[model samples]
Target: MSKIKLLLAEDEPALGQIVKESLETRDFDVTLCADGQEALQTYTDHQPAIVVLDVMMPKMDGFTVAKEIRKVDDTIPIIFLTAKSQTSDVVEGFSIGGNDYVKKPFSIEELIARINNLLNRSLEQKNADTLKIGEYIFEFPKQVLRFRESEQNLTHREAHLLFHLYKNKNQVLDRSLILKKLWGDDDFFSGRSMDVFITKLRKKLKEDPAISIVNVRGYGYKLIC
Candidate 1:
């Protein structure tokens, strides 16, 4: 059996060493970094299966590091460690692609549990076959969207976004939710990218007169079918 690899970034030397040693003992291959810049570099070099980041660090913040990582890989699980536990802070972490969070002073046991839980959850989510939305048929596995007499091929992101829209058909799917779920970040560029995909989907589904994906102002979009 192979050990799971994780990149851990913490500015505090004592805490960083403790975490690295602890996880190593539990059969994890841990790469420790003292700052966000180093963390990002190590991440690219190591290609770890999971990432553990501390929110505050020298050079760059963990949130920034996570954003950089998200640009290349959206599905990798990210766990954040921070002393700040305000509601807004937690939301920001998740909005920026964090899979889980551990507050300062957290026990190693708790951290281990969160890490295992995310790893398990990652293995459990598998997309289903197809969906019937309005007058169109979506073959999810094949990334095909079909309307009468016409069919459109979809990219992986396109197919995934369409699945989310279909799941929330007739209801508003928050733009932040879309960005976070697909792009793994709700930053400006991610939002703009999502807008492009929305435009693409609109064009693809336009033939179905009964189906429309409308932008719900500042909140998000609604897929009405």
Candidate 2:
């Protein structure tokens, strides 16, 4: 089997080298970039399976790189490495299409664990068939929602949120559980962002009046069909 390819973007030369070497030890083909621009270029060229981005970079910030990457590929897993542990920063990362947020000074083991978890989840998604939701067909791997001949492309997070709701159709999923599952953390800002994505999902799934995502006040949501 081919080794999993990883793109590591960090301005700190020493840390980047250490991370690259460590990941390589675990059978990953690591491509290290010093700045956001180079990171973006490498990402395009290599099409790595996963990306580890440092929040603070020279040419462009990690958030900007994540946003740009999302434009090109919404499903690629992105893990942000940042010293900033602020809730706002975490929320921003998720809002801009990040799959995971790792605070700086983290252990290599933790990072490796996160990578494996995400990769496994992604693989599972790929093997799953399209799901039927009312009149729409939700394609998990493609992050698309199709109704009749019309189709709508969704962001990674949007598709993930919708899938979880659909999986628990007619049940009220706790808000905290949704936040923890999707964002990896249940914070105030993350909850607010979840609300925003719920709205977006509602809008996208609105073509079928029979399908409704009901907001269970003080709780989470339910996908009714």
Candidate 3:
């Protein structure tokens, strides 16, 4: 199998070295950069398979770097590595097409698992055919979401979660099942993260009165049609 290429952009030298070494030991080809500018430059030059970018940096912020990267390539996976845990920051990261986010002081094992999960999910999405949920039509290959006369462009996670729910439409999906399947974890934190995405999805599908993403207390969620 071909080795995965990873771009790790961190401001702290010690942390950067540690992450780089850990990834290399896992058989990944990692390119480490110290700031956002260099990270963007390296990304453009190397076109790594994935990127792990720090939010706060010297030259530029991680969100800015992510925007620059998205301008050049729309599909390469991006995982934000930041110390900020505020909901707004996380939402901003997702707005910029972030595939995942790893907070600072995080375990290397969790980081590796997230990287693998994101990559695997990206691959799976690339191979999906199509999915239909309630009144919405999800065309994975075309990357288009259609609902009646209104059509919305979705980010990667939106598409993935919608399709997965469609595949199991009308059934209640446990919180843990949805989390691990979509985000590689179902812990308290990931559970909260999933809630934000769920709210976003609900807003997008609000036009369809027949469709509902109901939260089942202590159980999971039901994508009712």
Candidate 4:
């Protein structure tokens, strides 16, 4: 059996070694980097199935690396590890493209679990890759939404947001549920970021007049097709 490939970026020497070894024992092919620049390069070179990044690294921070990665590929999951516990840090990580955030001094078990959860969701999404949203064809694994000959590449947040709304099509997808599930919080910043994603999705699907992502005022959103 081929092990899952994971990219881990941490600046602390001891912590990096321990994490790499721990994940390896669990049958992951881990490409460990000591800095954000190396992490970004490794991702570009090999494109791992999932990425684990430390926030404060030399050359580039975790959020910065995530931003770069999102430009080219939005399907890969990114998890951020940091000592910074400020809500702003967490919000920034999510707004920029992080799929999960873990604070420093975390147990390896917690990290492993989170990694597994993200990968499982990724696999499920791939299995149901093609969805017809009105006249648009949404390919989740490829992060492409197509209407006729026109194709739009969606960001990570946008793709996931759309997926959730599609899953609850014609029903009210609660605002709190989306904010918590996608951004990791229902805080003000996360809420605002979610609004941005929804607006973008609206535009992307606008080409198909039969589709509309309607705001439910204080309730949530509903995908009408």
Candidate 5:
């Protein structure tokens, strides 16, 4: 199989080079750009399978680039890289079609994992028929979660979290890994935010007796069925 194509749009020269080299080492074919305008051009020309963009960039912002990309193709996975910790920043990234977000000073290992996870999910949606978890039926195209007579339209974050947990059902998911991928940071504040989302998700899935989202003490969480 061909290497997965990636478009990386980061303005910081040193950091950009580091990310470019790191992704290349992991066997990804990456096209690097220094700003949103260049990034958008590269994305249009190459049609990469995935995108890694910095929210703060010159000549346009990551959000604008993501919007342009979405106009052409809504399926490509886009991950935002930013340093901001504000809740509004996170919400804005998601509102602009970002598949995931990573904060500044992140580890290469974390970025690699996010890329792999997002790509795997994209591939799965294209190849697999449906995901059946306990009594809930997940429909990827429609982004819907249905159980019995009730249904909820899942936001992108909710859908991705549920899918990840379902894929690893009955297995432990590291709290750090989840917080980083879902909220961009694993600090105390972000941890609390994640906890809130987890509670909401648990309540949403409460109708199904076979499903359980449990915290595994200080290590992580386990979604069992």
Candidate 6:
């Protein structure tokens, strides 16, 4: 099998080389960029399996890079490397679509472990096939929802959220739980994003009047058909 490609964005030259060499030793194909703008360009060109972004970088910060990446590919896993250990910083990372946050001076072994674990989880999610949701057939891998001859292609976030709701169809899912599961935190920003996704799902499913994602007031939501 081909080695997994990883995009590493770090402005520090010595650290960038060290990481690139280390990951190459472990059978990974690494594309190292020295600044955020270069990182973004490399990402667009390479489309690596995973992204490792340093929070402090020239041109743009990791947060900004993550936001831009999310606009194009929401499912690609992003790991933030930063010296900032503040709770707010961590929350902000997740809110911008980061899959994991690793502090600076982190052990390469631990970083590798986190990368492997996330890759495995992502792979498993991609392996899921079609699922029945009301009268619609959710094609998880394709990010498509189909009903009869009509179909709607969904964004990665939308498809992921809908998958969870369909999994618990007819059952109320706690709002906070869903937020934590998808966004890694239940903060206000993540909550608001979840609400947006819920609205999008409702709009997508509106073609089938019998299908409804009901808001459970102060609790959560339920997919009722």
User: What lDDT does the true structure give each of the candidates?
Assistant: 0.85, 0.89, 0.82, 0.90, 0.84, 0.88
What residue pairs are clashing in model 2? none
Arrange candidates by lDDT, descending: 4, 2, 6, 1, 5, 3
Expressed as tens digits, the lDDT of each residue in 36-105 for candidate 4 is 8999999988779999999999999889999999888777889999999998788788878788999989
Task: List all candidate RMSDs to the true structure.
Answer: 6.4, 2.5, 4.8, 2.3, 4.8, 3.5
Question: What TM-score would every model get versus the actual structure?
Answer: 0.63, 0.86, 0.70, 0.87, 0.66, 0.74
Q: Taking the tens digit of each residue's C-alpha lDDT, what string does model 6 give over 181-218?
A: 66767878778889999999999898888899999999
Best by lDDT: 4
lDDT for model 6 comes to: 0.88
lDDT tens digits by residue: candidate 2, 134-216: 99998987888999999999888888888888778999988898797677678776778788999999999899999999988
* Candidate 2 or 1, higher lDDT: 2
Model 5, range 118-192, lDDT digits (tens) per residue? 898788876644678889888755668889788888766677677778777899988898776666567798788
- Stretches of candidate 6 off by over 4 Å are 86-88, 141-143, 153-156, 167-177, 192-196, 199-203, 206-225
> Which of 3 and 6 is the better model by TM-score?
6
Q: Report model 4's TM-score to 2 decimal places.
A: 0.87
Lowest lDDT 10-residue stretch of candidate 3: 178-187
| lDDT tens digits, residue span 91-199, model 1 | 6787666777788989998998988987875544334466888888898756788888788888767877888888789999999977766665677877898899999
* Residue 205 CA displacement from its true place in model 5, Å: 1.5
Please identify which of the two predictions, 2 or 5, would achieve the higher TM-score against the true structure: 2
Higher-scoring candidate on lDDT, 4 or 5: 4
Candidate scoring better on TM-score of 2 and 3: 2
lDDT of 3: 0.82
